[model samples]
Target: MKRAHFIYLLLLWCIPMMGIAQIVPENPSSGALQSVQNLQVSDVPNDAGDEINISWDFPDDLDKSQITEIRIYRSTSASGPFRQIDAFPLVLDSYTDADDDETGHIVTPKDTYYYKIGLFNGSEEVTSQVSEGVSPQISFFNWGRLNVFIILGIYFALILYFIRASRKGREIYIRTLPGLEALEESVGRATEMGKPVLYMPGIDEANNIQTLYSMVILRYVTQLVAEYETPLIVTVGKAFVVPLAEETVRQGYMDAGRPDLYNQDIVRYYSDEQFAAAAGVSGVILREKPATNIYLGSFYAESLILAETGFLTGSIQIAGTGNIHQLPFFVVACDYTLIGEEFYAASAYLSEDPKLLGPLKAADWMKILAVGFIGVGAVLETFGIDLFPRLLQI
Candidate 1:
């Protein structure tokens, strides 16, 4: 009788605890942050490495006092019973997976990792839905060769079309603009001034698309200068650009059949410091007093200082910069200013090089497509309709 009573009492005592464990409060509010959103991932570059970066928007109510830590969970399957692999103190809302490897949490390339991020409030844990899997894939197409082929095809097509159009006696009318007229006069002024022509390629590394555009423009400018027998002074900021610029100027001289007139001293590399570079170029402007000054490439605050100095020297300045903030100064000072896309379009416009021009035309088509999408979206939104973004994805 005594043993039966004791067992019964023990069972009675444990039942409530078990019940409590099973019962999770519905819509329980915690002092800690509540939500996470906007997760994204991309492959790490320059290696045979498979990695994904994750970032998220934290809850508005998030505070240090409420949350103690964030627990990160990962799973191979999207619909997963995810396993917790890492935990971070709730000091920062963002965390990178790269730091988790030291803790023996190993991720292999063969397996795709989907992540679930959760916040550990003092009493309750709130978790977000698992993010989409990041999987790596390789392409069979040789992109390098394909790119070259595409460029050549476009070039040949444009040349043939232009030739045929000319033979048919079609008026090939192109719109006239002030900037276009200035190019010829700028070169002419340089020839008559008995001073060197100065070209400052904007201070940016080679990887920048703007710098590449600047180089293309330089080719045409150098050719014109070489033909005129005008001394051209080219100052570049990057070490990498120095060799490429030298080759481009050399080719331009060769094309003009005045290779003997081409001088190495004309193309010089200046310091990379923003202010220091501007100061050095200014000194060259002051001493050489070039009749025409061409400033092209990406520029920052130094744009005004350079333009002002060039203006004071009475050089017929033609400036082009994709930097929108610096455009105002260039517009006020430069005799010819190529705005935004015009600066990018300058090389193709001058050379009529189809390899470059084809891409520019394609980009314009893309803009039209984008504008059409925006118009449709606006119409839907005005009618209180939501155009689901997901359905558009392949």
Candidate 2:
């Protein structure tokens, strides 16, 4: 009986200690910040439909000194398996949950979502009550792009006004392009010498803007060549350019009322290999001893080779390309070189068609306006006036 009483008392004493061991202590960081209140969610205004704005009142009783960050969470329902959206400092009272392509959010319209803002200190998270459901709706028009819309309207108006004026028989004067002016002289020289005129319409694909511009100039050149009855030899670098160039040459002959003299074999396709085409064109120059060489199109490393060959053959070379790096080669090797917009302007100056001339005149006016604005902006910057530059940013 004595031994049984001693064992029962020891068991009683050990039960209290085991209970104490099982109890977990509360985290001190849990109460570091008071909960956020009055959380608000609304649709973002004047935006594409995949955005929503979130805002909340900062907790009044929070100790900001101890707090590190406030985290945001989003879910489809109030009883959520919530996912973290982002984190912000305690100073921010709002956030925008918009689709960020760079972040791979990939947000879509009309999907309702709930949000929860969590107050965090160290590793502890103390969350606020879930926000009410919010959904994004598509906006009909974006007012933020109003400035761009106005600028485009002004540009179109300028073009239309100039076109209408041009049609009324008002003469538009274009600055002279020496390279374009030499076209007539070169064709005439070839005619007088009884030698062929060699023309190379760049090696780039037809879709390139520079190549397209070259074709436009070529169309005008063909008319002159046909009128002078000068033999024209066009060597192409791409197979796709062959058909378009042939048609352009044929049309030019027809327009000149000398369709019978149009030769289909004149526009020939050379190898697409850059150096091979350059070598072939160089051989043609040496063999035919052409009096004039016109190379207008996109050019790469082969620009200097062709120009040098033509220079050696004593041909009056007129070359035009937008490639800035290759321009110096043409300038040194060719008789006259068309730089930058001069190459584009050649088509308008040569055609003198009101349809083309009007846009050209408006473009010139636009350039003048741009230069004037730049000059004014530079002067205003000295006075700490930033409004002028800011106005042109959009």
Error of 2 at 185 (Å): 1.2
Q: Candidate 2 on 308-360: residue-level lDDT in tens?
A: 99999899999999988899999999999998778878877888888778888
Candidate 1: segments with Cα more than 4 A from true spot:
1-67, 70-85, 91-105, 109-173, 353-361, 388-394
After superposing candidate 2 on the true structure, give the runs of residues whose Cα lies further than 4 Å from its correct spot. 1-75, 78-106, 113-148, 271-280, 286-289
**lDDT assessment of candidate 2:** 0.86
Question: lDDT tens digits, residues 1-394, model 1?
Answer: 9999999999999999788867755434444467576766544433234345667777554554776787888888999979987788755656556524556655556778798888777678878878888754333454435545664565566556655654455444334556756887889888887877899889888788888878888988988998889999998877788988898899989988999988889888888788888888889889989888999898888888888999999999999989899999999988899898888777667766545555555555556756887798889879977772432422
The per-model lDDT (C-alpha) reads 0.77, 0.86
TM-score per candidate, in order?
0.65, 0.68
lDDT of 2 at 20: 78
